[model samples]
Target chain A: MTAVRVIAALALFIPHAALAGEPIGQIKTQTGTVFVERAGASKPVAIGDRVFESDTIVTTSGTVGITFTDNSMMSLGPMSRLKLDQFKFDATTHNGVFNSSLQKGTLSVKSGNIVRQTPEAMHIRTPAALLGVRGTEFVVRADDAS
Target chain B: MTRLRLIAPLASALALSACCGPKDLIVVLPGADGHVGGVIVETGGSKLVLDKAYAGARPGSGASEPVDVSAYEVERVFAKALAARPIPPKTYTLYFVSGGDEIVPESRAELDAMLAEIGDRKAVEVVVTGHTDTMGSSSDNDRLSLERARSVEAQLKDTLAAKGVQSDSVTAVGRGERELLVKTADQTADPRNRRVEITVR
Candidate 1:
């Protein structure tokens, strides 16, 4: 765990704005080694654990699932790495933006309110592809080299 | 040693490629409701739409193929990821009495049943929204609606706490006459319009 934290932190070569506030989501299910890297600190994530935007989730020989505030769902397969880049929503208006990056491994998603009725509200970034999700279910896979 | 390490990974990658399909790929799956939505996968200055169930494409490739990913391939590739999918959210509606914040007797029973369905979940989020008919003044209706929503939100949070929802968040809002379930003129009352909507996730 400690070694992975070091490598993951080093992998974030670019600086980002400080993110702190209410949690934007929570872990709904997890098995084996599931972690959330936030503010340069790495910690294990259990069900019900709050996750904020900009948190990088890493899974090693395990899987993890999360439900965002807007009701979107994301699940990561084994040996996967994902970063929740940006998320903002107004439950009353159902307007928001959802963006994330999958560095490697596999991901499955179900679009939520923020993107269900609106177009171009959700995007998932991968090494070789950028996906515009339109209120649907999809799966993405990427190897490290890609 | 460096040369051997490089060659070893290359050999393993080649062996893995023989069985695995693409280094970067995407497949659209049918939703829980059986609706197969679409995705625009942009790579190498091109965009490909995967609109049909099990449709797939490879990123970074110049040409896009309308590949219909087979069930066997989907299962073989993303079984664990699919299994990790979270349960979808559910919403329930309960009506209130005209000019009163009280929940109708029949709807109370329904609320009880709704509680049973979500009482055991972890990280439960409940949103209770109160709405009313256009019978009364908008300001008065807004206050009544808020009271009605707060009433249920309090009852629910307290009950859920006792029932031991692992971690929960409750939000209450009032839509009042601004949004009516049943369209009506001013000073009109519709039982259907006096209601509360609850969403559990």
Candidate 2:
């Protein structure tokens, strides 16, 4: 009974650890300065930095572009704060979901196979409105200044 | 009330992000006053012109009440700022022979075209997916499809490395006969159904 319990515990723990280590995307380009906040720690964003779900990317005076696992690309302009809220893709079927929030500033996105497989799979949220990506490319800007 | 408003946006943001639909394009243009005057959002045969500041929108759903963007400013500065950003993603598809990982002879030219497209980019990431016809069992097709995808991925990595272009990541997946391009009955061998898709960014 004890051995079985330990085995079950290990089985549950292993997959969670693997999933947590899976990188959702990578920072392909960064000009000027960008930072990523993950798990409460903030670090400078550099070229080739892996981005994960729940990571918040803040760009102060430069632009940063990230290409996700599903081949979707997102470029953030200066003074932007974006978060990868959720991303799930089945590479084989090219079916997945992508959700992100743009707190402020400008963002341009080009949908990948996931969106081509199903249009509703991509969604971007701005401070004032929700932009459901139904097209191959679109630009969004969220301004909170009053 | 302030907190409630903030929470609502957050919750709705999550909700809105969960849905999927077909592709649509939206072009936002500002008025002479520097405020977002209207937007041209289109999908398929439908086109909508939204003149308000805020709007609840989705592709193919036509339009909803305008959302509040009173604080938003659509200026040339913002447009120019984004225009200077990085290159967009590029994708190419090449078909393969039935039940094999080999590319069809006719599609051999596409590999060069694909490589040429990524040759000039400073940064790159590649993803390859393989598919197969339904002639084989599911498990066998899965392995064959994966093998096809891996073959393309390996070639892409080798070519890029030989050129000294460092790819951030090269990932591949075999989807078996699940996502058929030509939707055929089981045991039917369709040439189009066997293919590999490569996406570079």
Clash count, one per candidate: 0, 14
| Alpha-carbon RMSD of each model | 8.7, 11.1
- Put down candidate 2 lDDT per residue, B1-201, tens digits, no spaces: 999999999998888756543222233433224444344443344545555433323344355433333324334435544554556666678976654557778787887777887776765676687888899799999999888888877767778677665654677889899888888999998878888887666
Interface RMSD of each: 1.9, 9.2
Model 2 ranges with Cα > 4 A deviation: A1-20, B1-77, B95-105, B137-139, B155-157, B165-168, B183-186
Q: Write the per-residue lDDT of candidate 2 for residues A1-146, one digit (tens) a residue.
A: 99999999999999778656788888877888899998778989788788998899999988888878876778888988999999998876678899898888777666676877887678776555565665455467666541
Q: Which pairs clash in the backbone of model 1?
A: none
DockQ values for all predictions?
0.48, 0.27
Model 1 misplaced stretches (Cα beyond 4 Å):
A1-18, B1-21, B132-147, B166-168, B174-190
Per-residue lDDT for B43-126 in model 1, tens only? Answer: 878888898988998775456675777989888989999899877777789976655657778888778777876865666777
The candidate that achieves the highest TM-score relative to the unseen native structure: 1
What TM-score would every model get versus the actual structure? 0.82, 0.68
